[model samples]
Target: MTGNRTHLLLYAVEDLRKPLIQQLLAYPQINYSFADTPSELLFQIAQQPPLLIFCRTTERSRVPTSTPLIILCPTHEYHPAQFIHEPAIVDIVAETDLMRLPFIVLRELREEHAIVRETHRLRTLVEHTPYGVIEVEIDSRQIRWSNKAMHHLFGYSAGEMQNLHIEDLHPNDIHTTIINAFQQMSSGDETPLIHITCLHQDRSTFFAILHRAELTGTGKRSSSSFLPMLLVNTKVSAPCKSMPTGSNSPCARLIKDCTISISAVVGQL
Candidate 1:
């Protein structure tokens, strides 16, 4: 569980002179980082961002998405969400409600804790499952984690998958499409259906369907993970040969029979 009174990043020019800055710093619930200019604030934002921020409406353009901004402007004329490109914002204290900032901070802390707890629970559920699971980072298409079954399906040992990127495991054209789908899944887009071919230790390939969704982690940081249920139906319907070919090697004949069985099953899908 995370601390309810976690620090929030804020950017202000000559922050020491701002009256609200002193109060915000003193308040245990809100901890802010003060920057002198938009450029400085952006630099700090790339390094560390707060869950919620306090800044003037004119400074809205400077806020980062990681730190959802709360405008400290006098007028409630603009919805802070619109003026700023941040995903969400809670306009608790405008200039008119200066006195109420402390109370709102306390309330926001409690509500924020609840949201964090729920997200943790969901991630726990996904992580604890017996099914082979993987969280693929969208931008880089890297394998974040792999479950027990996934470890078995691929020859890679426990920590070995971490060394391999998704594109390296999956072949060419499918790599780009899968990476894009994973990103969309994280952004609340429709769940991506992936039919990925995983290579086994002996260099044999097997297919599995990937169920993907965006996991909203702590502080709204997002990553894409999936539950892959291995489909093992190779034995039941192998290709039947009325007449056996004498010329082919035993290994060649066996592989040919397995391929035919896989084709029939895929046709049913």
Candidate 2:
């Protein structure tokens, strides 16, 4: 097998039929190994874990709980309800439907690849974005992650920011207000775009607009969910003297521009 091909492990007490073996081998993108016993299977996994595992229903218990699996059952014996508690089982197929195996594997691989690509694309966007973004653990109110732009905006290194609480980024005078806002968000209240003062590492303060959104799946807030805040600095030097009479101040213009830009970005996300 070449280094780039997907590796699969097949565990069965009895040999798979010749047709099934040939079906899997026909896919050039896949390379596979067979093991009749649990110990041999585990040894192979220890050396180099396969991307996915194919196992007989009888041998399902022997497969590692962390690995994804496709279970093969005797014809007319497949029961979907029986594997409801087993999160590791991706799909269950009857022995007679072995022809579907290759298609299933390819479908899974394609989906996995798409997820990887999307994750990479998002990470790159975050790293390069001009807007400061920070992710806070909803339950603990601790700073969990931030991008380079975020670090630069607050004048703190990535290491220092990791140890600071979410409150540390704001001035002490408004800590109470910030806490109240967070409580409301946690309680599922509709929060308007927040305008607040933010503190930098040097203790200098600046005006900013804060936009908050949940970072996890839809539903009630959970411990695993994150509160991601997009910070846009609206601080500007005294209104530009070059402006025409009664025109909006630079700060107002900047805030309006930021609000529109952030709304568009959030919509895409």
Candidate 3:
């Protein structure tokens, strides 16, 4: 199989009709291979994973976890309930609808390509941005996700930061302030941009501007819960001439503009 063409695997397809064969062969960009037995199919899959698999409904249980599959069911045996809960099954078609295979394959390929492009775009933006981004669980206060810029700002390697809590990034004197801010934000109160002292992995202190926004979960908590997340953005700044007495203090001037800019960027993500 050539790298330029999308490869498809056909497993245990008995009595292949001429029209079905012709329909598959019609696409120049698609290359296909057949596997007669379960062992042969698994061996071929392990050797070179196919873009999609075309398998008989009876053999659907043999399909690997997370591998995209299109079930070929006989017209009389078709039932939507069997495949509805399976994430891997993209679509099901009756044996008489063999000609529609190429169209389904092409559509799935386009969607997969589009997702790859969008993921790359977001990763590029996150890595190149000036501010260090950190995502923390609001309840546990643990660090969940962070960007490369965060590693640079905090003097911590990627693995070192994973086990840290939000309080660990600040000095002992400011733990109360940080906890109060978190509580206020959780209660749906507006948290204005503020200047604070932050600690590096080596325990050195520096002045930085901090902003956070709540990220709510879209799906149920059982499957995956991104809810109650605090998306924190920080940028190192020069020492303030005078400490911030309040939100309207002189030190606020240093980070006033960042409030709107960071919020806009996070909103887009």
Maximum-lDDT candidate: 2
Candidate 3, residue 24: CA error in Å?
1.8
Q: Cα lDDT for residue 147, model 1? A: 58
Residues 172-240 of candidate 3: C-alpha lDDT, one tens digit per residue: 999888777766655556554355678888888776656553321111121122213222343445554
* Residue range with the least summed lDDT across 10 consecutive positions in model 1: 228-237
Q: Candidate 1 regions off by >4 Å?
A: 1-6, 13-26, 75-88, 167-197, 204-207, 213-269
In order, candidate lDDTs are 0.54, 0.72, 0.68
Q: In angstroms, how far off is 13's CA in candidate 3?
A: 0.8
* Candidate 2 worst ten-residue window by lDDT: 213-222
Candidate ordering by TM-score (highest first): 2, 3, 1
Best of the two (2, 3) by TM-score: 2
Estimate the lDDT of model 1. Answer: 0.54
Model 3 earns a TM-score of: 0.60
Q: What is the TM-score of each candidate against the true structure?
A: 0.59, 0.64, 0.60
lDDT of 2 at 101: 84
In model 2, the Cα lDDT at residue 145 comes to 86
Better of 1 and 2 by TM-score: 2
Give the per-residue lDDT digits (tens) of candidate 2, residues 1-269.
44644467888735675766778767877767777787888888888887788988878888889899999988888888999998898888788888888887888888777657655665566656687878887777888888888898899988888898788998898888877787676667644333477888999877666655443222233344677766777555222345432227544455456545644553464
RMSD for each model, in Å, please?
10.9, 7.0, 7.3
Best-first order by lDDT:
2, 3, 1
